[model samples]
Target: MRHNRTQHRSRRGTRSITAASATVLAVVAATAAVQSNAFGTEEEPTAVSQSPTEAQAQDCGAGTFQAQVAKAGDTWKARHGDTVLYTGDDMFAAMNAGLDSLTPNRTTKERMVVLGSGTISASERLKLPSYTVLDVCGTINATGAVATDTGPIFSRDTTDVEVQHAKITGAPMYGMFFRSVSNLTLGQIDMRLSGGLGIRIDNGSKATPATNTRIDDVYVSGASSHAVETAGLDGVTIGTVTARDVGEAGLLLNTTTHAEVGTVDAQNVGTGTGYAAFRMANRNGRIGDGYENNIHVNQVIARGGGRGIFCVSESGGAVIDRVDIADTGNNAILVENCYNVTIAAEGGTVSGAGGIRIAARDEFANTSDVTLENLTVTDSFIKESPCAENTVIKNVELVNTTKDVC
Candidate 1:
């Protein structure tokens, strides 16, 4: 699948902030600015609440055109203008009630601001509809056993949906999940939990892939699966993916094309597995009927991970411009059964790692058009085994390193 399509911008507009909401808006704007800087993008960042104090102080319930769910002692209240939609202790119910009060079948976007932190059962999720924006200023702590393929936040087959300033904790099947969604934006999300995947987006069929997705400044810690994973996505833009002590890859892209990744910073991720800080599998970067350098990464910093970078399973057409990796358990960088792959195009360093390797499996075509240039390798090696074709290694500086090429 060639996903070399132009990214479409979201049609959401900014709302006027009152003096009372200035503090909350400032915090949200600051977080988005930091993410934009990290991604090296000039696009305006999405606004989100950063802390509990800010969430409480920002009484979004007072807005003329927005709905809100606020905690009042032991009970929660959902209101829109003069209408009181629901009042209960169940946060999930309160949120749904608030959402139900919005303009039905809205051609334009409507806002739902959830205030206060509370526990939502793992089996319960806040479902977002089209032309909807949900901003949770407080944390959502998930409890109980999750049903099959469930999460704290979910959206399916929706268009123009955005979630901001969401802080999710506790163990759920998935922190946040979206299926076949288009024009989606996730900004300033923080997931600190044990087990489950951090964020997952995918399409149900290969014919209809999710289009124009943007993820800005997501922090995932202690996830058993990938921090951010996308499948069958076209035109995806990621600002930064930060992972710490994660069980799998920091960012894993499968059957995705036309991806622009800003930075991946990972530490102690996928310590003993074949997963890498950044990995691409199952025709990740293929463009059109052939392959080109459609997948571009600005930088990657991996320390004490299972692997630094991996491109396998007939996936190729990627250029990782820079990398800084150290002491990885598996190959620091591995390109197997791929094509048109380039590593360290702008120069980088690999020290005390398992070294770089280029190989091919019998099940697929040999790895070809692979280039490794402008790199400094220390206490490592560079090997090209059972070799490929049109492989180039240039301007490489080695210290106590060996090369085995065939």
Candidate 2:
């Protein structure tokens, strides 16, 4: 008899679970191996030999849980050993069914591995279950005619989910919107021509913010809004992100803590009233609450449209090591009412016509305790307003211009 997921969920106890358990479950699920079989024919489902690429894809992670999935007709089927656990029209449904069929225990681990490469044309949002790995080697395209303003994958309260090697296109709102998800990992994901934000990670109305989130090797292009936006996130790490042709900011972080980004390359960002390629602000209005702290950006390269880097609040300190800006439509760096911030460009190039602009918008606005060091601007580096009290500049070099030192 097939298991009903709704009944299983209803039977789940309300026992308190530790946050550490989510991390352990995610690691276990991510390392599972999966072997592929061929399907999608009028004949009965039969096992075909796995190809070299299929075997290599399964080896991406390491674990003991083993499962197989195949495209059978218009539906997808998931199996563990010989038992067919779930069959559905979309990958999310098949994955949820496979997870529901698993025996609930502390020692048991589960994973769903995609077999064939095809597109899942989703008309509605796909919500993922907790403590499971959705390894999609294919693409998911949203084809809804009505703009419902939803992401392809929208998770409200899920935990420990890892989505990898997938491409999402044509989402009406955000390509992937994760809310209140703990221990989430998105690796090698691509979003193209998204009508709204490319990716957004936020914990809405949750007591604990989203923690231990990692996004690596992501490429978002042609987004109508920000390419990657995050808020109410803690212990987040992003690496090798490339956002291009975005209508708004390339990457925006609000009320985020303990963030360490490796490299970001943003090109041709901002359409109307957009801020910058990278923006850091205090959206929660929790000043000095220690919820927004310790943001470190290693490398940044921005070209064409919008400001280069914008610090829009007096909260959330940041340390930027290197920046390369060119063809910026506004100031290369705009610091307004920010504190405890340091922007240092060591051995970097800034060829844009606009330079760093630091000022206060109103009486309450101020920029202080900021340090600019070791920067080489190819054009004039102008100061929009009077230098803030305690502002420091060191080893600055300007070429092909007379204005320097703000």
Candidate 3:
């Protein structure tokens, strides 16, 4: 199957503005100029109330068009290939009603442009071929954004779209969901104050998943669970995706996926009783080959989360052979129920989140084949457990440094 690619553009044309009188016309014309800066919309920004003074629709370039707004309850829909650009502050005034009135039909090629502060309803399902882009010039404030039901930017099957610099917040469910969508690219995505998992790359099943995309400069916060999850996303390139103030692991990835995580900082991620910072499960086939699938490199900084970095059970073939963890709230690197996981230290303190009660230790996954190469110790762990069997402490160094574990 191929995606029907369509584009929307704006053109120049002149139309007469309705006038109450020449005097009233002058006033509205002035108002329209100010509105062009406010919401008259040279290009849609946010929604503005209907004006009795001016009764002329602004020109929406060629393929480009402005959504017709009703008093407050009225809705206008878009046909296939029609692109709606917004420039309003209220979500209700932005895209929902305009999108809801659209006649549902087969996937043809339509795109919804998110301008400023807008809200998308849970019941407002944007169907296929109808790609949505979160395009905001300055800041897309979703601080009060809300989705009542299973609110998501995507559902069912979505293919081909680009979302940039839009803050997605206040959803009863996942912020942006990729169900069975294939071949989509999400860049500069921000998930703030969401009730569900921030962003889900869930294929909904183990059989089929989302593939081919670059997720970069994405930040997620205030999720009940994992901030960024890739349950079934395959062949995807991820960069600078960080989750703060989360309830679970910052990033969760599983299956035959390839990813490069740069600087993962999860503060208050776990809810005092949860999983690892970076947890990759599902024993990828070809243990050794799949082991290659294990998170290759990462700079995980976790403080106040249940477990720092965890790999378990069937998530074999992948190895935590070498990771640099620092200032952890609990166990730095906890490996359990899996194989080929190793711990190599770097930096001043490793998963050593300056906490008094913190175990201040790195745990080796038990009941599985795992090893640590060139593990180091500082004056902090002098009073802790000793190294033996699968563990080795080499060239331990800790002096002028303040590692409380000792």
What is the per-residue lDDT of model 1 for residues 1-406, given as tens digits with 9 covering 90 to 100? Answer: 2223222211110111122123334544556544432312112223464332233223322222367787767788888866899988899999899888878888777877777778999888788898777777667888888887788989999988877557889888889999999978776788998888899999967586898787766899989989999999977778789998899999999998777777899999999999999999998877655566667787989999799999999888788889999999999999998888888999999988499999988988778888898999999999998798778899999999999987
Q: Rank the candidates by TM-score, best first.
A: 1, 2, 3
Please report the candidate that would top lDDT against the real structure.
1
Best prediction by TM-score: 1
TM-score of each: 0.85, 0.77, 0.62
Q: Which window of ten consecutive residues has the lowest lDDT sum in model 2?
A: 1-10
> Which candidate, 1 or 2, has the higher TM-score?
1
Q: Rate the local accuracy (lDDT) of all candidates.
A: 0.79, 0.64, 0.47
- Report how far residue 7 has shifted in candidate 1, in Å: 22
For candidate 2, lDDT tens digit of each residue in 1-406?
1111111101111111123234333433443332221111222223345432222233332223346566666778978778897777766566556555555542322455565444544445656567656555555666655245367666767777766555677745778888988878776677786567888999887757888787765788988888898888876777667888888888888877666677778988874444788888873212243222267677888998788888876543567789988878887888776665677735466776768876765644456666677888786575747656556776778787555335
Give residue 94's lDDT in candidate 1 (0 to 100): 95
User: Which residue pairs show backbone clashes in model 2?
Assistant: 31-62, 31-63
Per-residue lDDT tens digits of candidate 3, residues 1-406? 1111111110100011111122323433443343333222224333345331122222111123233332223332222235543333445444454555444552433334433344555444333233433333222223334454244455556665444334666643666666666655554566786567777776776576566544655688888877877766655555555778788778777664444444566777774654666766664312233233324433566666666676654453333323444555555655544444444434324435332111112342232334444444332232222222233334445443343321
